[model samples]
Target: MNMDTKSLLIDTSTILFQQKGYKSVGLNEILKACNVTKGALYHHFPNGKEELLITCLHSLNEVIITDIEAIFSRHLSTKEATISMIDTLIHQFEKDGTITGYTFSSIVSEMATMSEPVRNACGALYENIQNIYCKKLQADGFSNESATSIALFMTASIEGAMMLCLTQKSADPLKTIASLLPNLLNSLQ
Candidate 1:
């Protein structure tokens, strides 16, 4: 029950934070969303909102890392794996019909300046994602230096395309990136 309550709070808080910025979301809102009391929240997060935010960021990162790993594990080549990942993301957005955007972008944009821990957590997650891509590229036989550079570019490009897709209310940007990624990655070999 204790672990369930904590997970509930974290999951509820993540959705709220992703939909609404960190500054705009209140502890009361999170509490109400999860239907958990202050005592339970405080019991799990002794440091309060900042601590909760950090925990939420970590949770979100773990989910993304797991998804990326699964994609690589299932696919034979980095290019195929990356395209499959993008297809999954596009399918998700199309099904939801609303682009809630990435949690890392929302948190880093809103809270990074004021919270060092939040900033570090977001930064670490970003690096971990890039490393995943780098490892996949290396496995595909790219040189270390080239793989790292392409990984950085791929990560940044996908994030940027997501933002564009959200803003434009269309998945064209992502589709364009997805279509171009195979050629772009293949060019490096």
Candidate 2:
């Protein structure tokens, strides 16, 4: 039950933070959203909102890293795996009926400047994601330098595409990126 409450808090806080930035979400809001009392929240996150934010970021990061690992594990070529990843993201956005950008983007934009811990957590998450892409590219025969460079470019492009899609309230940006990413990666090869 302790784990359940902590998970609930993380989940609820994730949604709230994603929707309303870190600075805007209060303990009361999280408590109401999770249906947990102050003591329970404090019990799980003794450091309060900052702790909760860091925990939520880490949780979301782990989930994405796991998903990326699963995608790469399918033995697909780097190009195919990347396409699959974009398609999966598109499907999720379509299903959820919202394109709020990536979770890290939301938090980093709001809190990275103000909190060192938040900045570090966000930095690690981004690096992990880039590493996933780098490994895939390297496995596909790209050199270390090339793979690392391309991974950074690919990650940045996708993040930009996500932001564009979210801002435009349409999947066209992502779809276009998905269509073009294969060719772009191939060009690097």
**Which candidate has the highest lDDT of all?**
1
Error of 1 at 68 (Å): 0.9
lDDT tens digits by residue: candidate 1, 66-183: 8788888899888998899888878877887545433377555665466788878888887988998899899999999999999989989988887777778788888999999999
lDDT of each prediction vs. the true structure?
0.84, 0.83
lDDT of 2 by residue, 1-189 (tens): 455998999988998988778899889999998888999999988999999999998888888788888987785687888888888878878887565434478655755465788888888887998998899888899999999999888888888878777778777888998899888887879
- lDDT of prediction 1: 0.84
> What residue runs in model 2 are displaced by over 4 Å at the alpha carbon?
1-3, 100-102
User: Candidate 2: lDDT over CA atoms?
Assistant: 0.83
Error of 2 at 123 (Å): 0.9
Pairs that collide in candidate 1 are none
For model 2, what is the alpha-carbon lDDT of residue 128?
Answer: 91
